[model samples]
Target: MKILDRYLLKTYLITFISVFVILFFIFILQTVWLFISELAGKDLDLMMVIKFLLFASPKLIPMVLPLTVLLSSIMTFGDLAENYEFAAMKSAGVSFQRTLRPLGVFILLLSLCSFFFANNVIPYAEYKFINFRKNIAQVKPALAIAEGQFSDIGSINIKVDKKSGDKGEFLTGVTIHKKSSLGEGAKTVIRSKKGHLISSEDSDLLQLVLMDGYYYEDITPKNYKDREKMPFAKAFFKKYNINIDLSKLNAKEGEDDEITNTHSMLKISDLKYTVDSLTTDYNKEVISVADNLYQRLGVTNYYQVDSINPKKPKTPELTSFLNNKDKFRVLDVASSDALSSKQNLEMNELNFRAKKKDINSHWYSIYEKFIVAYACIFMFFIGAPLGAIIRKGGLGLPIVFAMLIFISFHFLNTFGKKFSQESGITPFLGACLSSIILTPLAIYLTKVAINDNGGVNFDFITEPFRKISNFFLKFNKQQ
Candidate 1:
């Protein structure tokens, strides 16, 4: 029995490690493809790209590990059953549960480690990943601008028809639009035949130099006849220089703390603190708004107007006291004041609700770490038992089953979280929705495997569709 347990454990670990490596590599390759445009042609060093992937990899583990567990478990148990090893163990009076004991212990420890990594390591990795991308953008401002597209950098919008040269320093067919941040009327437009970006390590600015450009400025007309003419000034320049301030965009030595306020950068404890503080503050703000509105409108409470003193000029009915023009003026003033107050109150309420919703989302994220950790154990139960029942080995059936199950689980989790963030459901239910559905399924699969009952015959699933196809064929032949 001891020997059997050791063999099973060894095989399971080997398969798990192999599956994890392959899946992790595939996911990393997908990430590379997604970001290739941003990182490519930016003169990025190999080491920097490697470091970016490293920082980004931790967030993928929580997604990849459970799928790995599912696939590996299926492959391991399916191989054993196909080889008649399980039948031999059963003949020797070893139950399926007993055979699973060692692997169960290993899975339990792995779940703990997963939780610790998600709670402790992933946050730091996410923080670093965000800052690394930002630094990369700052390193080469041109990286922010894609070829043949308009890119917004600060107050200026730049479009390049093409970029060439070894370092992407030469550009052609450049158009620059300078947007006015103030309430000024029109934008300044500059079109150039060619342009190039100049940068220096010592200076915190990006210089865009253009040649043979035309600048256009719209001049506001002074009168109706001037407006009919639609006056504007255009100038041609041989050379032009525009300096963009890069002081804020450039990476600083110790700005990590400033960017760490995002929800992805916080641990469970920090998330709980934020949720609690925000809830308290939101409730206080609600109360304050109610109180302030009551005082402003001179009402004793929400449902009543004060009438403590009879002689204190009982609120006069404007329609009864005023006539014609005076009544219109008074009503107009009252309506305008009421509308302004209502708008202000509504805006404040909307801001408050948005903040509260954000706090709920953070709470969901906090619970997700633990939920994902337990998914590993649940996936093992599902995959192992179903695999034994199917009696198929290798990647063929196991990979398909694992993907279908994981995609369903991922969809449920994402949908639930989105609904929770929109306040349609509680955060607890949203975070645990996938686990709740999968737990019963795992238990059912275990029972079926233990009882030697075959789990879902594919023939049964396909029978109705097969009959429909046969009916159509017979009708077509008759016709």
Candidate 2:
């Protein structure tokens, strides 16, 4: 690289690093602040929040990359223009595209990095982040039991009167109250002299080892006033398995083993496989779904109808309904043609449904991520050229403009994606939205920048207009 090119590249790199760091801090700080109320009384420690923010970093990277480019590009070129480096470079027989070579190289490298981040790293981070939250929630399930606090585990709330970790377990004087949507008003209250928690291997059921307890089983009768309440004198259990299913424990593991596992949070490869599968399934449905309809109605189409000849005026041999024999023959021929056409219409309707499902399916989560990443490329070109045109590199004006432009782009893409999810729009259109909208604008701006007519004049334009307007106003005042 030439010395001038090296200098420009160095400045660009420095600007990128500084801006990215700032953007990361700003984004994460805002997210953490929003959870201030939620985190107020929680047992969340430093390492936990740190872990959360660390896992959250991947989610922020894609969002910040475009902003980083916008800020850094504006700063870098604004510096070049301020120092007259660009003018010197222009005078020295360097073309506009040549000057942009370093920028192009940097953007291409960044795009590859962004793509990898979006595909593998970001997806895995999202997967792990969700798992991390679930695991954290399940932590200290004993400490989760507060004094007089009805702690919920599935449909069961257990409050402990007293706790003792004497035996190196979750020992407690436990009172349990459980309810379910599918249950009667059967209240089972158990008070144990001592109890502890134990988890069965590979199963979600937790074994509550209760010893020396009184059991009260309250059952509501068919009549509310005639309730049945039974109290047991004493209970002694060395060990007992609490037959409770951990519905919360069904939290999705960070694995793409099934399609349900990757409903929304999916990677590129996973989405491709799913979309391909959906397409194939839809095609197969189009072929065999007519059979489902046919089977329901007991209507069999041995062969597809080629055509019905309405033009042929053929008379029927059997004519009994009409007094006129000619009318009976015409009616018979018309009915035969109508029957063939109806069969063909039914087949077309079946095909249309199958085709519609294929066209309007929700793109796998991975596909959505790919769309976001591809949109960044258009954002890159747009940001760079816009910064050059506006010539406002400071955070105040530039940040506002950059954010407005990119946020609109982002929102539109999201809007389209949501519409696609609802089957209101095609996935292909949703995926390529930013590219479709911004590519032409980028090309136009690039052409303007190259020809030195970047939509506005720097010295010769605004100043002259101001002077001419002042002159006309002064003449009007004198008259």
Candidate 3:
């Protein structure tokens, strides 16, 4: 909005674009090479490959954005510092922080944009990118499946003799073994006389059409009067479709089931609703289980207490036939009642414990997912401030820095979550640990830059601690 803001923003923007473009292309080249290597033996066309790349680019942007922010901001500020532009601004009665004010706003905006991209756009793009690879693999499985090498496709292990291009199919001499739940005994081995891979129109499928094959299927039977010689034999145009449950395979790759794969783009309200639903459900389960357990525990404890603290005897009685017989009858009556109540209490306790566990599990799931959504804003602060501090505008350095931070965050968050589930850490703490780690770093960087002390070689400072640690160990060992 202000003239100064616009001027500094221009610098940051130019730096941002330059780094993004260069780094993106380099990434593209690497990915393309990987794609080529992956598609080495497959019948993948140029257009299919291009489509794969196109789908993949958006996914790359989210990953690159944080790095781009760091590099660009650093370069822009470093250049301003180097050119005496910052000094000129200071001499002209503008404070260093005042000059940084506009850039701060820019960083804020960039962080918000990154959040949007990470949460909405990138989730979808990443889902698509994963699917794109899957689709490519599906289309040209010649590359995916190798000759003479066993490949696991679903619950089946298949080995093919050879594949040819001119015919655009795989040859016979195929041995297929299928596995199932019946202790690996439910097996199917198809020694096909001949086989070919084919696809139908508009269908994302490939079929292994086998001809004149004797199918050997091992059956698990409760009782067998006489076993059949061969399970099946036919001069068959057997159509085995090459289809993958992409949704099932790529479920974790996206938000949930890839079937629920959404472009909930910029829909904060939607996420809020979903988050609220989970929270409500989680709380409901907690209250419900806790209440149920409390009631069961109360009943059990009350009965047990009543049993232990029996009514005081009217008086100490002298031994007599009537009194002794009456006490025995009383004992029999109390034992019957106590046994029934004890059994009921044990059942209630078991149920309460099981329900309690479910409640905790549900609560944890909600906590972890919510933290993931909030990570957008937290990561922005970490990334933008880091970018400003590092002041290296080219993609190479910034990208590496961004990745290290994010990947570290990602890995820790996941690790913490797993531990949290087992009660090794609190779920809430585990969820927010990444933000906690990054926030202080962001603040420190902003402070450093404000004081005109920007970008340190952290490695130099860190080396002493490491050296001292190593030195002490060696000295102690020698002694």
What would you estimate as the lDDT of candidate 2? 0.64
The per-prediction CA RMSD against the true structure, in angstroms, equals 6.5, 9.7, 9.9
| Model 1 regions more than 4 Å off | 145-155, 159-175, 179-187, 191-215, 220-230, 234-261, 300-331, 455-458, 461-479
**457 Cα displacement, candidate 1 (Å):** 3.9
Q: What is candidate 3's lDDT per residue for 1-479, written digit by digit as tens?
A: 87888887787778778878987998788777755545455556778767777766765664466556655665566566657676788789886568667766666666666555556665466566766655554555444556787766655667778777654466666767776765654367766756676644345555666665666766545456434543443333354443433223222233353234232222445545654665566556555544554355444333322232433434445446568779888779768767866886687567655444443444444454445445544554555445445544444455566666767876776777666646667767766777688777767776776666644565664467678889999999999
Q: Model 2: residues >4 Å from true position, as ranges?
A: 30-52, 82-88, 91-96, 134-148, 161-173, 182-193, 211-218, 223-240, 243-260, 263-267, 278-373, 454-479
Q: For model 3, name the residue pairs that clash.
A: 70-387, 74-391, 206-242
Q: Distance (Å) between predicted and true CA of 240, model 1? A: 7.2
Candidate 1, residue 74: lDDT? 94
Per-candidate Cα lDDT values, in order, are 0.82, 0.64, 0.59
Worst 10 residues of 1 by lDDT: 302-311
**What would the per-residue lDDT of candidate 2 be over residues 293-351, giving only the tens digit for each residue?**
44443334432322221133334356555677778777787788668668876887776
Worst 10 residues of 3 by lDDT: 244-253
lDDT for predicted candidate 1 compared with the true structure: 0.82
Candidate 3 global Cα RMSD = 9.9
Instruction: Identify the leading candidate in terms of TM-score.
Output: 1
Q: Per-residue lDDT tens digits of candidate 1, residues 378-462?
A: 9999999988988878987778788989999999999998889878899889999999999999999999889886755756644
- Indicate the worst ten consecutive residues by lDDT in candidate 2: 302-311
TM-score of 1: 0.79
